[model samples]
Target: MLTPVTDIDGAPFWEYAAQGELRVQACADCGELRFPPRPCCPHCQSFASEWRRMSGQGRVWSYSVPHPPLLPEYAARAPYNVVVVELADAPRIRLVGNLVRAAGDPLDSLDPRGVRIGQRVRVVFDPATGLPQWVLERA
Candidate 1:
């Protein structure tokens, strides 16, 4: 797996994930949560920020499956579904991740045919990458 690019602003998110937690950046003053952690808050333009832990529960908002002419690096992971998950804690904050059948399952392990919009899912950290992956809440 490719190591995620991390910077001063986003490092905390990965650090939290390394410890089996899912967190998002929030404006310390406004208390608004944001993904893709950045130095300044978009809502209030505040440099003061913090990481907020999430419930890790969400609903599938949308999804996509790449077809023919797959990239060499992803050809083997073909037939996988990339889902946009709307966080239960912050409906406005959506995340992109693979919708797997179970925790630790390969990206392509879940049958795309079985995935449905609004399906409930929870976060699971990959042991190797510490990157959060999504699994059906009740697989």
Candidate 2:
């Protein structure tokens, strides 16, 4: 159970996650997509924006296995993976999410030896929570 900071700007992202979708901020003025869900697009500085759903597919741009939990809340889940994934649909945008599977189901468990930089992955919604998360996509 990861706890996220939901603020005015980022609330919609989490809300969409609750609905099993990843919604990014797309600037109505320039059609450029942005992450972290801000009010204005950095490219055009336009306040006009809309929510765009992603394909939920991506590749591991970068990854790390925490020897110790970076946050107190994750102390119990130490040695977990945190990956920066470049979404397939949104080529220029990347997202950060937990690589996990359902309880009692060992599907795509994070392996230190198996995971490498640039591995292909896809978004997987946690069946229990119905939240949009990520998992390794088997080739």
Q: Which has the greatest lDDT?
A: 1
lDDT of each model, Cα atoms only?
0.88, 0.74
Across 24-81, the per-residue lDDT of candidate 1 in tens digits comes to: 9999999989887898999999999988899999999999987657878788888789
Q: At residue 63, what lDDT does model 1 achieve?
A: 93
Q: Estimate each model's TM-score.
A: 0.94, 0.82
lDDT of 2: 0.74
Candidate 2 lDDT tens digits, 1-139 = 5356789888888778777787788999999999878888999899999889887888888877777635776665666777888999997898876666532233236554566778778887665554556776868
- Each model's total of backbone clashes: 0, 0
Return the TM-score for candidate 1, rounded to 2 decimals: 0.94
